[model samples]
Target: MKEVLVLGAGYAGLKAVRNLQKEVGDNAHITLVDMNDYHYEATELHEVAAGSVDKNKITYPIKDVLNNKVKFIQDEVVKVDADKKTVELKNSGQLRYDYCVLALGFVSETFGIKGALDNALQMTDIDQAVAIHEHIVETMKKYRETQDKEYLNIVVCGAGFTGIELAGALVDERPKYAKLAGVDESEISITIVEAATKLLPMFSENLANYGVSLVKSLGVKIMTGCMIKEIQDGRVMYATQDNEELQAVPGKTIIWTTGVSGSPVMGESGFKERRGRVIVNDNLLDPDHDDLYIIGDVSALMDKATDRPYPTTAQIATRMGAYVGHAIAQRLKGEVPEPFSYNSLGTVASVGNTHAFGLVGKKEYKGFPASFVKKMIMNKSLADIGGAKELFAKGRFDLYH
Candidate 1:
């Protein structure tokens, strides 16, 4: 029987295993290795951080999702030898593989902004989200005793999807935290700083404008064309639109969601990279090796329509995994694989309970209806990955106002 080893049980890796099981059947031995036993919903991390949803809701056990079809190994991958077709585990012995899939996802890019990495919190996973939630709760408690205005300020150091989403969530949770800590809602402040000239620079200008307006209406300050010079304890230094350097803005908490880079393992493996992404062929396989496949955030699939790489999202990663799974199964049967192509349906971003922005199939949606669509998308992902019962258990169908 052929062996398939998938590293990093994330969106892409899990999807790959699912499709591979369906195609290859009981003959092939499929193994999934991951550092964590649970698979986290990366998209809902901002909501988890804001306390809008429980952390457990955004994560599902890999064993539960995979059942017995694929063997689950809860171990970190220490090294990969593509040439030798072997993977060295942190504790477990090295395992050889007939084929390997690298879907290690991405790490937060601090861009070397001084204290940004050491001081600022990130929204990468469920644990990070929980940490942000706990930090906010603790900060609120400290503010009640000292009444330090800095404790009420939160600076989100990016205007991208993660930064914008977190800013909106923080704004929504401000009143809840204020009530819980016996403080006034007016005392809390949220600010977003973006190095780009406009928020959501990837989106259409009209949509970007609408998103900025919706967030601004939620009492979040959106500062565009601002470059962060320094991030120190209790302050953030930046350059203003006027090209003049500015002093640090006092804030107790700073969240860095500026950028993302591919995993170090890719470069360590001697794969050709551009901006930390492996340069793969159209089939999402490495040009240097035939047995190696890359997908998700670590793989750069070019968008022929735009002449650039596709944006890294869960939707794209899931779709890529399906492709890789099917292709690998074909290869196992001594057949050729098809090239990978992306068909973007659209995107949606939530602002608060009843506000969202969406661009779906050339149609624009906003306000309450868009929020409804966004919630449905979230629920659908849960259902697709786990099941209806898992979605219910995760409390993702909650329509709490």
Candidate 2:
């Protein structure tokens, strides 16, 4: 039987395994490896960080969705020797594969900024998200004891989609923090520090402005056009264009949401990559090796229309997974699958649970209506990953709230 080794049980890898197993059946044996036994929704991590939703609400066990044809191994992937067709795991020794899928996911990118990785909290996974919440809670306790206002201040060091959503979620949780600190909600400040003057480039200026305004109206402070210089302990140092002198904002909770790069395994495995992302060919195969297929955040597939790579998102990752699954199955049957293609459905950004904005099929949605659509989109993604069982279990049914 063909030994198909799939690395990482993320959206892309898990989806590909499910599709391939269903098609290949007993013809091939699939081995799935991941460090964690459970899969969490990467998109909704902001909610987890803000304590708006429990981590369990967005995570489910990997074994819950695996079938009999696939063997699931919970372990960290160390390296992949593409030339030798072998993968090294932290605890499981080494494994050989006839075909390999690299869907290792992303990591926090510090962009070589000094003190960023050391001082700022990054929300890349479940543990980090929970850490942010715990840090905030502990900061509140410190505020109650010392009555330090900085303990109640939150400085988000990015205004991108993740940073904006996180600021909004923090706003939603401010009341709880206020109660913990024995202060009014207004005393707990949430600030977004953005380097770029223009924010939310994903949507039209009007719509993006609307989203920003909504977050700001909720008492979140947004300081755009301020380039971050460095992250210091309990402070964010930045320099604005108007004044090159370094200015500082003191806060107990400092979050780094500037950006992310693909898993380090790509570079360690000798794959040609930029910022841990490999630019895959039309077939989503590594330019140097046909046996190796890359997807999700690790693979950068160019959009011929815009002459730029498609932004790595859950939507595109799922599409990549489904495509690879079907393609591999066809190859196993001695047939060729068509080249991969993609057309995005739309993009949505949620500010807190009740406010959202986005474009779907060229239709602009905002306010509570957009929020409903956003939740539906999230539910749809969960359904695609885990089907009816997980969708009902961890799905977002609080659409009306």
Candidate 3:
């Protein structure tokens, strides 16, 4: 029997394995490897980091998502052996495979900013988000007891999707946190500092202004064209267009959500890449390796119409997984796999629990209407993975104004 190995239990990895299992049942042996026992919803991580959502609500047991036809292995992939067609695992030794799928996710790229790696908190994973929430709780308690404004100051270091969402969620959550800690809500401050000329540069400037307006109304301070120089000792130092020298923004907590790079696996596999991402061909296949395929954050696939790569999101990752799975299945049957094409139904960004903005089918929506659509999209995502039952179980059904 041909052995198939897929690394990472992310949207791409999980979906690929599931689709492959369904198509090539009893004909191939499929095994999925992930370091985590549970698969967490990465899109909802900012809410968890902001202490507004429980981590349990965003995660599901890995076993719960897979079937008996596929074997699951929990271990960190140490290295790739391309010549031998084997993967080096930290605990499980080497795993040999006929076909390999490298869906190994992303790493938070700090851009080599001084003190960032050592001082700033990044909430990309479940553990990181929960840690941020716990830290915020402790800080709020200290602020209540000592009446120290420093303890309650939160400086989020970006204005992109993750940074802006955390900023808005903190706006809504700080009051509750203050109540829990017996402190005045006015004592808390959440600021978003960005180096860009304006927020959400990828989208329309009007949309960015809309997001800024909403967050500003919630008491968030937006610092545009200000570049963060360093994060250290409970203070973030930044520089402005006029003042080149760094100025400090006082805060006990600094959360960095600036950027991400392809996983370390990219360098190990010796794939040709730009900006640490593999530029895959039309089929999302690694042209250099017939036995290997790339997907999700690790890939840089350009849209023919725009000539720009699609943004790495859960939506794109899940689609990439499905495409690769179907491609592999077709190849198994000695047929040509279809070339991958991205179809974006819409994109949405939540400002807080009660408000959001998105472009759906050429129609723009904001406020409760957009928020409602966002929740529906999430619910539909859960249903796609584990059916309607999973939707009811993990879906976000609450509305807080």
Candidate 4:
């Protein structure tokens, strides 16, 4: 029997494992590995960071999700030996494999900006979320003691999905937190710093304005056409529009949601990569190695229609998982699998607990209705992972809230 090794238990890795088990259970020994034993819903990480949702609600045990036929290993991946067909684990040493699927996920990209990595707090994983929450709470506590307004200013760097979500949650929660901490609500402020001309620049101008209006209504100040140059102690320096004049945006609590890159394991493994992502062929396999398949943020595949690289999202990873699983099964049967074709469903960006904007096909959705769509997509994601049980346990079913 062939040893099929899968690395990284994020949405992509987990989904691929489940599907691969279904296809190759009788033909292969499947071993799934992840750095963490628990699988967390990454899209909702901002909610966790802002103290809006418990991290437990979003994370589920990996064992509970995978079948008994698949072996699960909780360990860090040190490197991949492509020539030898082995995966190097940090603690458990090496494991040989006939076929290997890598979905190692992503890390924050500071673009080598000064003080961004050292100073700005990121919302990447559960631990980072908890850290951000503690930092915000401690900042609030400092405000209570020192009565310094600087402690009350929460600066969210970048106006991307994570940035907007973090800013909106702070806007929704900070007032209540201030009130509970015996500080005036007016003393707390949430500001979103975007380098773009507007928030969600990918959306249509009208829809983007709608999102902007919604956030502005929450008293969140948005500095558009702004580019941050450096982050200083309790201050962020930036330029407005397309100018050279630098301005300092101050806040002790700085949440960086700028961007993300592929896992470092790609480079360590000697895969031909750019920005931590391996360029894959049409079959989603490395050009030089057919036994190796790369997926999720670690694999950068270009879209044929848009001529741009597809955004790294959980939905795409799930689809890729199913494809790889089927591909491996076909290979085992001595048949070639079809090339990867991506059909985008839509995008739903949440702006606080009760507000959102979304696009499905050519139709646009906004406001509370869009929030409903967002929840539906999240629930569907849970079902895709482990069906009804996963949905009931970790799904976001509170649609009306």
lDDT (Cα atoms) of all candidates against the true structure:
0.84, 0.92, 0.84, 0.86
Q: Over the stretch 151-233, how does candidate 1's per-residue lDDT look in tens digits?
A: 88888988888888888888888998887567788778899888888567667889889999989988898877789888888
Residue 44 of model 1, lDDT score: 85
The C-alpha local distance difference test score for the whole of candidate 4 amounts to 0.86
Cα displacement (angstroms), candidate 1, residue 207, comes to: 1.8
TM-score of each: 0.96, 0.99, 0.96, 0.96
Error of 3 at 14 (Å): 0.9
Top model number, lDDT: 2
RMSDs, each prediction?
1.5, 0.9, 1.5, 1.4
Clashing pairs in 4: none
Weakest ten-residue segment in model 4 by summed lDDT: 175-184
lDDT of 2 at 183: 97
Against the true structure, whose TM-score is highest?
A: 2
lDDT of 2 by residue, 1-401 (tens): 89888898889998998898889857788999999999889999999999999999989998888888889999999999999999999999999998899999999988988889989999999999999999999999999899889999999999999999999899888999999999999999999999998888888999988988998999999999989999999989999988999999999999999999999999999888999999999999998888889999999999999999999999999999999998989989999989999999999999998998989989999999999999999999889888889999877788654
Model 4 misplaced stretches (Cα beyond 4 Å) = 241-245
